[model samples]
Target: MESLGIQHFGAFVLACIALALTPGLDTFYILARSGREGRTVGMAAVLGINAGCIVHTLAAVLGISAILMTSALAFAALKYLGAAYLVWVGLRMLLARQSARQPTVTRGRGLSAAFRQGMLTNVLNPKVALFFLAFLPQFVSMQAPHPQWGLAVLGVSFIGVGMLWSMVLAMLGGQVHRLLDARPHLGQWMDRACGTVLLGFGIRLAMQRQQ
Candidate 1:
């Protein structure tokens, strides 16, 4: 029904697609996990990201993001927390030592660990919450009589579309997995590299200010 979300349908879809395609922390996380792990873990990670986005959508709908965005102190506080979380995750990865039976351990603890990490990574980003706060309202139709519903629709649409692209990225990790499967030692180095990338993202996020 048009009441659902027909206003600016073309524009909304375009905007959602553009944002989904844009490379960001989410993309990097999925790719990193997939390349390090495999499709199963990657898919779990994708689900975790979506689960985190669900919280963002709810926060935006409930106006929590509004509070964070409008208050400088609040924004900075959340930003730092997110940055710290990223750095901690990165450190954990880097400092983790692989034992001789690392492959067995990895196989033993697969999708669940990846899923939790993915969810935590997205939820702690705070920037994702801010992004939803800023981006979703643009496509919400005033004529919808219930702008909140319109916002919800836009948020869900973004999530669905975004997840589609994320899955593609996760699949691409399959290539990396195959490449490094033969070189077990390289996998350790690869995790360290991904850990470094996460640290970089944390530093970048820490330096961001409301614009």
Candidate 2:
């Protein structure tokens, strides 16, 4: 693998960390659900999100992302599906606004269900796959030496950053839930906020250009 300069590596790490902190679908879903259901569900969402990241990593490594990227029909079809899913999720949240006056928990098959939800959310979103294909490769230096190794390192780093940041968010959600548990009105508002944010992200993802 090619050696990176300290400055380049530092910059890359910072950028990745920032990306992780940004509120995306995974983040919003985890935080919102965590606040409502408790840490267990939040953690489940985190696991699911990471699982999705793994899929992205594998797709990028195997060159499946390239195929999706180059094919217009495939890209369009995936994009619409992802967009529709987001819209659907958003609509669900909006409709639930009045009904969400009180926090209610949905029984799952346990953490496995949460993890699956997280993974599916990430995996099903074609934009995420495309993101890995486009974003992670930029840091790799193919001309330097072992391009594959470099890509591997970058991909792994992205996943690690995502995992760590998500755990932190999950913890925060738990804390916020505790703080707001006594205040149902505040909790309701938080749910609305999270739902709105998620809806916006879904829309943005749908409208994203393949290029």
Best by lDDT: 1
Highest-scoring model, TM-score: 1
- The Cα RMSD of model 1 versus the native structure comes to 2.2
| Predictions in order: lDDT | 0.82, 0.74
Note the clash tally of each candidate.
0, 2
lDDT of 1: 0.82
Candidate 1 error regions (>4 Å): 1-6, 99-108
Local error of candidate 2 at 72, Å?
Answer: 1.5
| Model 1 TM-score on a 0 to 1 scale | 0.90
Report the lDDT tens digits of candidate 2 across residue range 1-211.
3463122566678889899988767887788767766788789889888888888898897789898889988887877777676666566655564543543333234477567767776887887888889887777765655566666677888888888989888888888778776776676667556557767877887787777
Give the residue spans of candidate 2 off by over 4 A. Answer: 1-8, 97-110, 143-146, 185-189
lDDT of 1 by residue, 88-179 (tens): 88877777787633862234468998788788878877678888998877676557767778778778888899999999999998788888
**Candidate 1 residue pairs in clash (backbone atoms < 3 Å):** none
Alpha carbon RMSD to native, model 2 = 3.3
